[model samples]
Target: MILQALVDYYQRLLERRTEGLAPFGYSPEKISYEILLSADGGVVQVNDIRDNTGKKPQPRLMNVPQPEKRTVGIKSNFLWDKTSYVLGISATSKRADKEHAAFKSLHQEHLAGTQDAGLKALLAFLEAWTPARFAAPHFSEDMLDANLVFRLDGERTYLHERPAAQALRAQLLASQAEGQPPLAICLVTGEPLPAARLHPAIKGVSGAQSSGASIVSFNQESFASYGKSQGDNAPVSERAAFAYTAVLNHLLRRGEHNRQRLQIGDTSIVFWAEAADAQEAERAELLLADLLDDRPTDEQEAARIRSELEKVQKGRPLADIDPRLQEDTRMYVLGLAPNAARIAIRFWEVGTLGLFARRLAEHAADFHLDPRPWKTAPSAYRVVLATAPQYKDSASMDDAASQLVGELVRAVLTGRPYPRSLLANALMRMRSDGHVSGLRVAICKGILARERRLGINSDKEEIPVSLDKASTHPGYRLGRLFAVLEAVQRLALGKQINATIRDRYYGAASATPALVFPVLLRNAQNHLARLRKDKPAAAAGLEMDIREIVGGLADNFPRSLRIEDQGRFAIGYYHQQQSRFRQEDGADSGNTESTEDHIEETQA
Candidate 1:
């Protein structure tokens, strides 16, 4: 399915006449130098074509004849290769002499009897070039091992781009095909064609080999079966192999700010939309990127995404939001991770654009809070970051985060209950750190809410998005009472103290209220007495709110709270604090909505 989908997309690009895409029988490669040759066979210059916009010199990618996949033997590319093959010199190669010979030999045979001026010039240059040319300072040391292409001294286009060279490419392919036996039925295209012995290299996956790595290969003896070897084990056609790799590498292009690609933890992902209209396909691609990543946005883009999300929340179909949108458009996401000598398929998903739009909207709703914690939608990366240690803020982590990110994205896209570990991890972070941000509380609520909707915990009451004053749940009331006690300490002490009861006892109070609350209450009374003398009205308000919360606890806190209730406890505490902050001057305002003013003043 993966390979077939890629082949189909490659055909789509060709049909659209997409620029910068490599044609069949060729692949896009990073070319760092162009050897300008005179008509007779002498070096004019080794021009550096690398882009210097970034911190380093980055190679420019170009379409060239597909290079040979060499291991230990000396094989040559059609018209371009690294210095070791093209110039017989290298930074590290023991067989530079043999490699240079292979390059010259291949060109000598292929360019024989050529009438094109450009082809003759390239062949003459190869005939006269040698590794010893480096001794006379013919080119810069930086160009020693860099991949190089050829062009006539006065021409702007490379030799491979000349009309005669292209014609020769077609003729050579025909000759090779007529004499070869049918290898097998292509697994990707289902056509009887030549089988690829070694698949093309896939680049741009982070942490993979710099030269590139394979996705389909039988490298070990144990990997083969039924007397088949290498690529015969899977039988992907050479054409299909080239097409898929070309499209994938195009999607994975770096330094172009490719919208179709995003990195989540250690998983490198690429996504695209298949639509009849190219513009419509691009619209869907950009929208999905906004959904998963925190891409830079201006006022207009942010407002547009919000408007679209509002329609989805109101149960409007995608076509209704944008008449040109094809709700049935197919969307594909592929994630890759690095293995030893090959790439691993971390995850692959195919669905309709409408389905994913609805699911992502549902994802936002599940995690929503009354006093929303974020200006933009909370990214999956932020939700997962609540679990990681505090210092690592790169939105990436070790291998464990990679696994969790895959599971998290799958749940959001499929409308399933979030993984149980997600809730546990957030709760554990709150317990240990004692700094419960609105983001962490929101994630806990989302996990529990999804479980209830999916009937995993159907017996439990529906968790409200805000404070539920009438509820009699023990954990809820205890959480509220803890907030009140902490508030009283802040009132009595103001900014004179370095720590409060919250910093000391939040973990114990949430987990085992029975053991922690009685001690907290006794100390709260002394603080209340002091406040009652200095500010009687404030003390009365705290006393009234405290009585209301304690009355529901049956005058006795539970010995221990369940894990589900612990999540509710965090939500309850967050809600009460937010509500108190919503009031004018800490006095009751009869509103649940709060702003950042109170949060900045007290939470810090």
Candidate 2:
């Protein structure tokens, strides 16, 4: 019986897309499952499903659809994982409370027994059942079973029959305002319908009827009517409502059938499609509603979908096109704004920038390789567009800045910034300087390390390794502390620069050279300026290397400063070089003056 159950379970899993296995369904012939007992007497089960099946099912993710070529902007495959739920419904206060506790305990038992599918299904059911905070209105049993009626007309649906549906629709329409799209009626039955539940009678309804109206029966496990079975109506568990409504939603949304108007008593569901005919439209509504109700909406499923999307191409550019040059075409095709903030950050486990750069470069290229060449925007423009579809070009940095914009300038830039809101969320997890500020520096630092692998160390290379809490801080800019290490770098490279006068006056200079900071003080100042700009451009579009800007700032030096403390000289040899240059220049001027004075005296 256990083997038979496992086999039956495996087959069912293949037929339907479930939590663990891929969509293409595992081949039963090849799948192998084994249970091993742990030292603690707990069982451990592993499935060589993917290996045996040759190719796992490849079901497209939910919530998001694939991007089309003509669409403009960046599309993110961002998703949250689905959460499991355990809904407990019952009559009587004590029974309901007991049922809820039982469900929780049942879930824990499923986890213990290693019945993964049942456990996951229970959790998903529970998640859907859990309303954040709903105040249940006290109702008599008669009120709960009373049938309500409604009608669907154009965009507006009316409950001409059932006072319950009627009352709900009237309240909805009023709250929605007159000019807004008519709200569709969703009949939340006061009680689960009974087994062999016949359609509610509408003896007086006539004008609000749909053509070719047919009674569609569901077993109540359908997402739209999932919890209905707990009531007296649905009995035979073998014929679950999943058989009908699930298929209906799957077929309609997947574009299988072409039916429109779906009439449920006085309530009518009108189609909301651009080209869908009546019959098809009704089916679509039913399917969409089913999806919304059945699918998990919390962070987990979203995370899962997002992870899968990242694995796939949520949005890709035309392969032949360069991302930097294809901004306009990409936006036009993708419907994204050029300056809208859409950033893709990748982290490397080894803490190297080169790995990130290499991977990003690869994925960015792969994104452009759309199979439908003629259907998309130009390859160049589509490659580097933002992830927002409604992004406008008027707020573009190129148009605003016109001449000068750099990395920091662009980072702060926005214009209905596409997906930046999402990016900001991701950025929260990023570490500022390896301590988990977020992904920004983590990604940048990784890129730097990747570049190092390629033997490319540009002149100015200061990836803030850590925040100096005790040192004289250089103030925060663009949410990060900008260290004035550019001064240290230039001083070492035969250039002279001083720390900000504030640092000098306070005598807060560290007693050692800042070995990690690779830029000069002047360059650091330039970075600060760039970050302060209102309309910054993308980092990829910056005309000059960020290091050079910092390097320039490192050149500034005060000519009147001289110090000789051999034993405890906190300043490096670079300080001595700057002093030497000032002395040399002073001596040359003095000599020239002396010669002129002698000549004048002689003439006298």
Candidate with maximal TM-score? 1
Q: What tens-digit string does per-residue lDDT give for candidate 1 at 1-604?
A: 9999999999999899887688987888889999888899788777889989889998888899888787777788888999988888888998888998988998899899999998898888877776667764458778877899998988899999988898888777677666655668999988888888788998888889987898998989899999888988899987899899999898888754679998876678899999988999998887777777754457787777667766876668877777877788899988888887899887788998888888988888898887766656656666676666443222235523556676788788889888889888877767876767777788788998888888988546777887899877777778888888988998998888688877788889889988999999999999999999988998999999998888877856799999888888888888888877766446444323344322421221
Q: lDDT for model 2, on a 0 to 1 scale? A: 0.25
Per-candidate TM equals 0.91, 0.18
Give candidate 2's total backbone clashes: 96
Clashes of each: 0, 96
Per-model lDDT: 0.81, 0.25
Error (Å) of candidate 2 at residue 111 is 42
Cα lDDT tens digits for candidate 2, 212-313:
111232424552354453322323111122222222222223212322222221122222221123333233333323211112256675455334223323
Instruction: Give the clashing pairs for model 1.
Output: none
Give the Cα-based TM-score of candidate 1 against the true structure. 0.91
Instruction: Name the lDDT value of residue 167 in candidate 2.
Output: 42
Deviation in Å, model 1, residue 439 alpha carbon: 1.0
